[model samples]
Target: MTSLKLIFSLFIISFYSCSYVYAADLKKLAIEEFKKANYPKAIEILEHALIENNDDLELYYCLGYFTHYLCYDSVPLTGFDIRKSDEVLAYLGKAVELKPSYGDAYYFIGAEYGVRARRHLGKGEVDRAVFEFRLAREKGGLPDWLIEYGRNNLKTCDRDAILFTGGDADTNPIEYLQLVENYRRDVTVIPIALLNRPWFVQMIKYGIENAINAAPISWSREQIHDMHPYKWKTNLILIAVPETIKAELQIDKDFEWELEPDFEGRLSAGAAVLADIVKTNQWARSIYFSVACHPGMYHGLGDFFQSCGTTYRLIPTQTKDTELELDIKCIEDVFMDGDNYKSIASVADNNMPRASHMLNNYRAALFRLLIHYYKDKNKRRAKEVLDFMESTIREEYVASGALGEHLASYRKLLE
Candidate 1:
């Protein structure tokens, strides 16, 4: 027993001597410093720790984060650019490999991918931007603030497609009719409220069976069915009604409207399983966002235009007499050219908790004000505001995925 205790004590002493010896502790201290915004001291310690132990994944990621923050700050003579995009990429790559299920590492890497996308953009690499953003969404952690921001901004065209709300009580009928039309175009609408029902489940199964037993050109129906039971069943149902129209349209597949109960979850899951679907498949980009209803005239139009470009002219002016009619028309214009009004960062920067609130109060306020400025046909103020947004987004901010790095401050406007 005495010998065993002596050996254990020796092992403990050796472990302590060989490891940290104050180095790992110092590395951790550096991370805390970085978190507290004392980057200079953090960098000093990180450099010390890295010299002693360069293979540490957390150390690399923290260093990468530090470098990224420095790049963002653009301190004079700080040589940071999208070229160093790979530095973060490499560090994150190792971090992820060292800890496969590390959510924080994934999140950081995803964020790095977003930055990579921006770098690619700066270097005129559209394909790379697309690739990085898709990967960011896949590996990036849950829908946290950073992820949501990147997702929303990076794929504005797609996500902006699905409008969540539309039409007042009076316009409900027309909207419902339109919804029916959309359903007809894609049969998933057939299931409607029955998506969650057992009957639909049976229908999907029957569809699968029928699809399988239909037989090939030369094979007997019985032979075909015998040869490929599962494949036939799965393929047939997949052709019926895919959950996202974008998915259905791209793969020539249909939805299992039966899957509506967990549609968003399915999107996230689909993003995971068919991770390459975004790059390889055109349909993945069809509807970037999947909200319930279509926004009417004054819908997401402003946001869309702000993010994209304003090549198209306004829908020809209409002589509407009533205020509600004017509002409805304006709303439609908002949806059609939503991208025109302001940079998404401008709209999103305010620390608003809920999008609904932003829509109701903040966004609405901006729209009213901008419209008011442009109402008297004050093209000059409109031009000035639009110019500021375009310049800010173009020169300052570099959005990677859904995550946008604000390059400049809009705070000056408030002042």
Candidate 2:
């Protein structure tokens, strides 16, 4: 009986070893497919792997993550399938069950909840939307560094400003700050992509009419709901740029400029709404675009964007000859000052992919500052920026990334 039991135990060990190896190989293959944007193929590979290794934590997490990408990134190509959302939650739920301490899984789970919240909001289910938003914040498991980054971005705007955010990383954390921490409650946060939806426009209009948190919109309910892209015949005129902004950009007092639409000669729905808001708001409230936003999202107003920390404020005056200008004082005051700098400097290298993306944004901002100071021949300040980058952003993140190449070139420039 003892000899039989020993042989059985050896056989069990061999079976599990082979299963582990096979699961690892499947994960590798699925990741390769994911990297190539073959999300469906990646999901298929993971599903097949899970059939044999249902308890594999990594497999479940990958399935959840890849399904999310399929739903989000490929929506135009594959239509928004409700079934996929159910699949994502199920896979991620299994992942969490397998490992309760899985932070990445938790983050994505929060992101999925955020998506549902937006859908609920779009459907005018305010209570459900708020509930899901709160749930998203609770489940996010966001790192301190990312939260500080959101706070830093919020600090850039004046009171009652309208801030437009770009992606999940930028928008979600800011929402978390506002919802959970009660930070920057006066500022209205709008995600640019959501402007494409008529329901979102109606919602904003309702808020504006009811004197809710939204910035005032001049468009009537019908107009806002039916708003679409149109060509502008006149150049955007600016009555005056704030003197403080002028001093920051070193612009002459008499310098005046008008913004013309890009060569496309057409505005997107989001840009049209933004243009109208800028025209109607008339500097009563500051309008900002998060640094995470693409330049294309600027809607031909790129030249007027003034860098204030991690956000770009639209100023009435344009730079004379510079492609980009930084508000050095603002950066020094908000981003690199006491508590904020401490949060950034003390960020742990947790190796979270989302955290890495946020860190790259910081690195990009610092790189811009480094170039600005270097070109101005302020070697001391440039060196300070470079040192900060080296110290805060790990060498591993910079070794082969695009930022690495930029840093190498700048180091040569400094030398």
Candidate 3:
């Protein structure tokens, strides 16, 4: 018994020592990410740090601050995302509770309320906003950046249960739709590459099926392989993981699931299972891949998706041709274009990648419409599509060489 006690004590000491050693490094990494305008990544790092040592007040405060930047301060506020808003409060409140004298925490609380006020005032709902601003001023005057955030933010867009499998770039549109417009709430998001782990798959399986707090799955790797999504009958396949994990998997030919010859690059065990989930579930739900999704997924899915805006939505009957009318409308109005896009996309240097990516996808969709009409021998509609595509591409992505080539080539083909 004495020996057992000694071993347990040594284990505890080792754990604490390791956490203490890594805590400072974690904090430093999060700060660097913050400087790079990678708010989500920064928060993710600190969240792990808190797990290492939950008692770290500064970590809590930093977590709260970066989360605010992610949701409100960094971009032009578009929606009242309760999930994020409540999350901000939970972290900030924990910080405040941990250290009542943490004036910055108080300031953040107030600024968040001020953002709420700004949203309210936009709709001519003045009283609540005033109260929130007053609360903010009581803690600290609104920082210049926070003031700018609320000033530029306004409500926009609409959608129904649109879920994203990738990063902020892919998710922001639906976030605005659901939060600002209070549109749809049934969206389910599974973070990138989470499907790569056997444990994560089991978590997804049980967590989703049970609708409860998911404990880490203890299944062996073989167990994970056998637990295909086809068995689950889930709706939709969202391929968001990059190619890194894809190199590790093999498609089971005996399984009757065929990824395209040249296009099916590779799939991790978890990703292959996820694809099967969409396939075995009767192909009823839409499978959308973000621009970041491996090309293998895009091509291997083999004409299953109708490229719509930034996402390639799984369509049963055809490709982009059928969705041209509705999707073109979505592109023009909704696919992050025009002055609003320019302003929001300009705020952070890092944001440009996703913005350009989204614009590129929309451009490709438009070009597809042109080709669809041209092939149909519908000269009038074809010409109309060509005109719209040319003008919009030039307006949004003036510097895209590929887009320029597409315009020149497609124009020749149309004629």
Candidate 4:
């Protein structure tokens, strides 16, 4: 009898483990419902799944996404109800509490808040919108597109050329045009600063040298024997790429290299250089570059920017693709006018003191460029963008922090 009881207990434990293992799959089913535009079905399944596994962290995360996506679908025109948004935000908040590491949870919470803040615009809620957008960038993993959108909107808000101020003396056409040109110019040249970055260059050289020496190359016996010559020659060539690229591009690498040591370094140097140009002319300013982080650079791209004291762009570079763009555009159009993405137009109109937000938008715009290019190619960059969804009491989605931490890891799995 005791042996039979023990066997029964073992069977029960196995069943429990199996269920948990399959939970993500079940949750995905609900996500499919979402994909098919069956929000009600998705919500229903998610609710049921959540009920069954109340402690499932991912379930909560998915529930948050379902609500967040719905919110995303509502914007300036179609519009989202603040009351409905509150419910979704509550779920997202719960998801974060259950799984603090769940980056998506944090992101959705911020996004929901951003919409609310925007909705409250002109009603003493501009500050609230800024707060929500900041949070969304922090947690949802700001991709370059989002940052650019936000940044442009911010510029619009600050410059006030298009609306509100009605093109006053401060919003002189030539002056505002110059501002746009200057900001765009800064973005086009961002890669120059990034590639010829001293620390980044130095680190890449080191890695390449090491990789070359260790790389299985077909070396002649004499060449192999002379390790000293090989090492010296390899190091020289490795260090030369930055200079070579700069020369070919006709860019001033030396000047960009000098703008390093921290984000402040970049911001201060840029501001200092442009001080006489912009009327305000602040001595030291913080410029936020909304960069999609990539691992190809020695320091994750974000850190490289931060190293110069520039605020890091709050987006992930890897996820940029045609589908994602469509997802955003579709969502954007669902809520706002198809062409009007000037959510931050208010900030620019106000002549906001800081230009950090403008910088972030530049980064995001660049990301859109990359995404546009990626869409033109026939290559399959991301290997594991699964079509599967999970089952839950509410809309549940599963995201792995470990998986999204670095580019190499993502390439390995995604490719």
lDDT tens digits, residues 11-38, model 2? 9999988888898899999999999999
Q: In candidate 4, what are the lDDT values of residues 108-210, reduced to their tens digit?
A: 5545654554344324343454454455445543433334343343232212111111111111111122222233212211222212223322222222211
Clashes of each: 30, 0, 4, 54
Q: What C-alpha lDDT do the candidate models reach, one value each? A: 0.38, 0.72, 0.52, 0.37
**Model 1 lDDT per residue over 1-415, tens place:** 9999999999988876666566688887987887787776887798788776767777777776676666544334253365666676676677767766544555455556645553453354556655666665465422233322322222223221221122111111112222212211111111122112233223322232111111012323343234311111111112233345434223343332111212322322211112121222333223222221233222212222211211111111121331211232332343324343344444333222212121222232223334444665765654554444344333222322212122122223322
Q: What's model 3's lDDT at 119? A: 51
TM-score of each: 0.33, 0.73, 0.42, 0.36
Alpha-carbon deviation at 30 in model 4, angstroms: 1.2
Best candidate (score: lDDT)? 2
- What are the C-alpha RMSDs, in order, of all predicted structures? 20.1, 5.4, 16.8, 24.8
Using lDDT, rank the candidates from best to worst. Answer: 2, 3, 1, 4
Cα TM-score of candidate 2: 0.73
Model 3's TM-score against the true structure: 0.42
| True lDDT of residue 334, candidate 1 | 38
Candidate that beats the other on lDDT, 1 or 2, i.e. the better one: 2
In terms of TM-score, the best-performing candidate is 2
Q: lDDT (0-100) at residue 180 of candidate 2? A: 60
